[model samples]
Target: MVFAASPLHADTSSTAGGAIEIKNLAKRYGSVRAVDDVSLVVRPGEFLALLGPSGSGKTSILMSIAGFELPDSGSISIDGRDVTYLPANQRNLGMVFQKYTLFPHLSVRDNVAFGLKMRGVAKAERLRLAEQALATVRLEGYGDRMPAQLSGGQQQRVALARAIVYRPKVLLMDEPLSALDKNLREEMQLEIKRLQSQLGITVVFVTHDQGEALTMADRVAILSQGRIQQLDEPKALYERPRTRFVAGFIGETNFMPVEVQSLLPGGALVQLPGGANPTEVRAEGLVGNIVARGDAVGALRPEQITLADPDDPAALRAVVNGVIYGGSTVLCVAQLTDGTELRARLPDPSRVNVMAGDCVGLRWPVEALRVYGADAGAEVAAS
Candidate 1:
């Protein structure tokens, strides 16, 4: 007699939808290592987005998880079951890809029913499940429409309904929204987020768009060169970036080179090497804090600085170089006395009405400075 319910069986999604654990996963294509020893954990019911630039191993890692591409060496376990060798069809995963792959000949209801029918579900139950799935995607009355009869968004929803109709253990999406127009994409993002939260399923999505990752993910995994550079909440990753790549990639910043003169308990006093008059400024928690005698660079966000009159005691005197008006806010590019280029963001363009060669001053809070050591050009590892 065979016992069916074993707590420690070779199963995937063993822990209430299971926790995905990847250990030292590696994938190679002849000489190029597409995915290089990536390890990460996707917790239960969490939405994780693999974010990176093109060719950054985000898709490769997704493929590895789906068993489309076997790793050279590594262990993949969902819950506690070893799924390293399991085929893609056996993994019980719902997937949506860039293209809406719904069959043109099949009606929406038939398409959603296909998965269940293949699993040997009874006709009456499969039709009921298909109707329920269409309702889940908010297409209750249009179940009989064929793929070509619906709009792009509607077709994608049909594909989604098909994927989730069978209630898979996990959901994996690879750039599912890239093909849609901007407004539609945004709308679908909110819809998808709501659906995922409602189902309480583990979702691993891949996208190169920074804003999408920041908005949709519970935690984001920043990937480059087939490895994870940083994995954290979007706010934490933005506020306290550990690497120079994280500082530069996540948002817009102005990098200014500075040489450390002395380190203080609360902050540091540094001299801007290229600034006019070699002005010394006090900054807190910057790149050179850990280093002693060397040149470093400080990152300043555009919104962090303020423009004011040169004669003001509170402002650092500089000349307005250029201005770019952007409705709600204006981007003012100014040159310091030492010819250091700086940008300041203001709510209104009228506040700093000045032409080129006009002298001004710039001021910023002490906490906005970010210090990076000399070799801040290191690339981020993507997965």
Candidate 2:
């Protein structure tokens, strides 16, 4: 049987939903491994986003979960019930695609009621459910309008209403806002998040947009080359990425080459190789208090770095080469003593007077430093 009771006759509003576990999943297309040995546990009622760049296998994994694409190996279970081999129609999932796939010929109300209609729900009861779903999406008055009559955001809202009108246990969205403008996309993101929290259904959203994932997902899985580089809460993922790919992908950062001097109980001390193009920096503060000399590189975020007074002894001397002023903040590019390029984010661009050819000291807290494996990169600088 399907994991959750059918929303048609069940009081799905109070349903807590079911957990999904994907184990040792693999998918291949000829010589290319599209998804390789992926495993993840999505908690009940959790919002998880599969985040990655194009061709990173995030969409492939989502398709596998939705039963649109069959995995070559491993298993998929919802609430301990195996559905790895189940057909798409039997999985009882709600889905919204990047494009609004609503029936062009159907009115908004008809589109929202279509799933319930297919389930043999009584016509009157299904229509009521459809109205409720439309209200949930704040499209109560637009139910009579055809898909083409509504704006893009309104169409997406209709799609969302249709997806949930049947009270689906899990909702899968594949870059549903990719086509919307930035402002509208962000607005829809908040709308989607609010509905997801209120509905308490398990949601798996796929997106290449890091901001979208960070803004909506309870946890994010960063995918690359058919594997997950890291999976963690948005704040944790941003603060402590476990891999270089994750650190680089999540936000702005600078990776510098350094030699590991010693690993401490909670951090590492390293020496920066002062070379024009010397690579690597060592960092710590991950899961372990201790670390061995691996393919680790020093990671420091742009915002965490600050310009220091020349008299400060704990600062790295750098010569300001370029400064680009954003609306509220400035991006300062500098050349270190070793000729390595460094970037610092200075807030209050209007107040800060940093300019090119200015010599400044850059410093950051030791705790803010992180060391991620360079295995994500093709070359490991010989330290």
Candidate 3:
């Protein structure tokens, strides 16, 4: 679970890595723009994740950076030097793909030394470095085993060892944990974070999984339709998503339609779709031009909502549709009179066990709601 950082193999000291600058990067197919005019800067020693669903162009941008896909336009640079058209083999970078691409005939040590071998490293030195790299990945004894003789996780560790043995300036990983099971994926997430921190290598990780991005990256860029909708640290992106797309994609939330009565100095006052009470929500992050008086959506996470006390008169009425018992929490699905579905996650499932068709009250703090411009997918029950 810890990297074996021997002085000669991996740089375990706290060091800043090379910065990467991408400018107006664009790539296109016959009729579709794979990477629209996009630009970003990855800070030295930062774990930057390019996150989005399929067709979001995250992979395209990554491939272009790796020199696997030639961009139609734009330039990429590392530490102020241009490598826009550099050959992939000459980039001096480490790469880990989703699939385990280890050579079946090569032992773990040989596979780890393959990159060095290509660079014409003497056989004995490469083998020594390979042994050190395996130790760095906590696979010290597995170096003599063939790739086909290792488990998926062990093979991944070998791949990681191979990538780091030559000391590349930057590390690029494309969904490297996608093939692992849930437990392994989580374990690798922590492992990767530790290794990256230890090596001080600039990492650009491409992943469609939001949890993975939030868990591993120092900064996350959420791309959609070949454009970045939001770029911020994990907590900031989750708590104050600037756009509806980001709010919905990063986590599950109930979005209620509301009519903006007025924009206040600190926030906005809006009336819920079917409620008479006008609630105030902090709208400091909304663009000035976009916070006009009209329709908007209120974003609230399910865990923020709770069952109301029997005596609370202002509680909203909801009919329980179903209750699902998770190990540590419970999810209650309910429906309002106007057909709006709401979900409340309770810490204890048996707190107030109301079976299907039972009417109950729901309560949530007004301050917990976040307001956004209403769009087509602004349904309250959307996850």
TM-score of each: 0.88, 0.90, 0.91
lDDT of each: 0.76, 0.80, 0.79
Over 1-383, each residue of candidate 2 has an lDDT whose tens digit, in order, gives 12224343523465465699999899999989888888999999999999988888899988888888999999998888798988777776888999888899999999988877776778898889889999999998887899989999999999898888767778889999999999999999999999999888899999999999999999999988888888899998899876677788998989886655566554555665353222223333543223454434677899998898745666777889999988888999988888888899989887678789988888877677765444545212111
Off by over 4 Å in 3: 1-16, 285-293, 310-314, 374-383
Give the candidate number with the greatest TM-score. 3
- Candidate 1 local lDDT, 78-156, one digit each (tens): 7777878787776767788888778788898988888676666778887887898788888999888888899989988
lDDT of 1 at 233: 95
Candidate 1 Cα outliers beyond 4 Å, as residue runs: 1-16, 273-284, 287-289, 311-316, 337-339, 349-352, 375-377, 380-383
- Candidate 3 structure lDDT: 0.79
Candidate 3 TM-score over all chains jointly = 0.91
Worst 10 residues of 3 by lDDT: 1-10
Full ranking by TM-score: 3, 2, 1
